[model samples]
Target: MNFWNRALIIILSLCFLLPVFAADKPNILILGEDAAGDSVPRSSRVFKRVLDALINQMHDKGFDVYDEAVLTLLENNSSHIRRTDSEIIEVARASKRPPIDVVVIFQIYASTQNLEFNTRINTLLMGRLLNVKTGKHLGNFEIDSGKNFTGPAQCQQECILTIVGDKSRILANDLGAVLAEKLVWMNNGDVSEPSKNNKMVTEYALIFDGFNAKEYMAIEEYLVIFSGYTRHRPIEIRHTRSEIWYQSSIGTAKLDRNLNKMLAELDMQSIINFEGNTFTVKRITFRNKEIKENNEVW
Candidate 1:
């Protein structure tokens, strides 16, 4: 096709794709917490690097991701102020920076200090998502990235020797990727709307049908950044029946609303299990479907 013909085809394609593109972008926030003085001893710069990777990736993908992990931790220290959904919204909007459309808040409990020989850190990071205005905990999940996953041979990385920077970029890359995916899922994964009949106005049970940290991470940076939507609350990896309740709330952008609808369109299905050359995306039906997708051995 000639240049003019190509231009005509491009315009037609955009007309078909614009509605999905024009949907609002949720401004996501990242919040990390520890019990006051008990924070990881040398973490001032650690998180910021991770923050950059996540935000940069998400930005490239299409969402407006904000780094608010620092401020939220400071707020957690204050006693009198009860963080309401509205306050969350204000916090998001108050940002001379963009508002945190969806939040990735984590209260980490790490057991790396207890190690002796081949020091392995077992961390239980409970990641919670909140709507900025309402203090509604959209979803919460446990992100368990055990340092032991690294083989002894892999531990030979000379660059991984820093006591403070013990966790390698590879680990960070994996964790960041997974977290990014979950962030995406939280921001965009299909959510079964909480019953409006409830006396409480906050919605509960933000779910990803089948959960895989990596699966969710791969798409997170891409969708939220490129798709123009905020992340919903991210749920942890677990097996349970009852809805995961919201511990706090935050207001959402117009993009978040559309994300919920997109997830709903996914039929609320997600990847649940990983087997050799096979993967499963589950829905509420509990019926398992195996899909054959291509993968290359790099």
Candidate 2:
């Protein structure tokens, strides 16, 4: 399904189910930048309350999560508050490990509008989750707290924090948890939090593996799931079989044929397995005893 359609389904699904525990460690890249000035003092730290509450809640539900404040760590008055979006993104990536499953980018908007007698001011919070490597936009959400939170009227950082809390709980209770779980599933499947580093196991199997925090990130880019085969076979239970059709370049042919040619010497059996949005070898299969020349996942 398209991202939006999937997001709609997820949101609807969550609206359908009660909140529950998430099964894995989660690395969250929180992007919070100054939205207005005289920008709220310590607003970055206050902004973190939203992330922390969500993380802590998910942690209670069983998830490993982390976050940071980019502009707050530096001087407040300096132009760091006005950093480019890419600069903010770089800072967000700094808080994460190499293979980030989810990147939660946030924005804080402080503004004023004309109202009866006095003006109405507010702080708006907006955020979205993106897949790090693919740069694909997964989902976005926003909320505006009606209270005027201008310089003097504001209760310092507390008012903003309260707004963040409201938004986060709403999102987490709905879109957040489901998407997070699906993302976590993609990050690592039935792989257990090892009592021992599975390095020996992965190396022997030739799948690259590493631990990020308490969880392991493993890659068997070559091991296409044959669907029917077991690494071992049984007399009656055994049926069907498959192989990891290898290719020189991991890049798929979806982008271009030149990519197909330049990545590796012409080989017939290797085919595009992990093309576009797919994760495992299950997406490809043999047909008429002849599926195509070659290809599979990244």
Candidate 3:
């Protein structure tokens, strides 16, 4: 074979292997909780041990776990700001190297009971998953260490470690499965296929500025027929301004195009803007209507 022929073969082989090697995987951030139900401090040895075990187990299951040290540094730098769960998610979302897809917060509960001459230590782990973009709860899972350890009081930490070592695999597997399913739902299934009606939906805010009641009504009629539109709730209504929250399965780009077409058909001039999930239609002008006929005309 000529040199060019060998190069072509290598290129084709790489094309086939690239997708297999670079397939999208959800980035996960795992957090621990203290007995008080607040986030466990990173300095806690128990937290470190549990986190390390869970991270290793999750890695073995083909998950990309976020580095806890980086998260801690982010939190420290933003110490002046309130560190609510939502805020932590926001910080992680903004500062994460690639980006955090899911955040899982788990709390371990330990109890002791006297069994004959020995003390029995029982541990249970409860986890809640949250989507970073939406900051909404995905699901929850509870894993109990079935085996109890009987030993001296000083052996509590050792027993807990044993429980974590044995149950980390189960916890990781359960979380990995759920995370995969949720990510698929969030992405609305395969990109090559049309989004289904039953797929996950996101709520968005639509604000209309400088629109009279009649023009607003016309827009509503168009929305009823808009593809992927589910429903809408009016937040405020006025001739000068109106706000509404709507749910849709389609993305913003399609919605923007549909709105632009509707405006053109209605003979209304407007500027459409999007910020995150919120959409704004501003500087509306009715080209064929009398401005004086509408109340509170802009």
Computed on alpha carbons, the lDDT of every model, listed in order, comes to 0.42, 0.40, 0.62
Q: Top TM-score: which candidate number? A: 3
User: The CA-based lDDT of model 1 is what?
Assistant: 0.42
lDDT of 3 by residue, 1-298 (tens): 5558756864663454321112434557876544353333444454566666666655554455667666456443324222346555665577323346677776656566756676776656666777776777877777665787556655565664565445544554555455445445554542222224456555578889987555777788998789887655555665467777676788888988998999999887889999977789985555445545443343
lDDT of 3: 0.62
> Stretches of candidate 3 above 4 Å error?
1-108, 111-120, 124-203, 234-239, 286-290, 295-298
The CA root-mean-square deviation of candidate 1, after full C-alpha superposition on the true structure, stands at 21.6
Q: All candidates' TM-scores?
A: 0.38, 0.39, 0.43
Task: Put down candidate 1 lDDT per residue, 1-298, tens digits, no spaces.
Answer: 4558755854663465321212434556765554345443224454444445545544544454654554343432344133443444555656422334566554434344323445454444445566664556666655555544332323442322343233433344444455556555754653322222332222223334444333344334434442322233332333322112121132233334444555465444433442331123354434333232212211
Query: What lDDT would candidate 2 get against the real structure?
Result: 0.40
Q: Tens-digit lDDT track for model 2 on 25-84?
A: 334555555544543323455445555544554444333344444323554455655555
Worst 10 residues of 3 by lDDT: 16-25
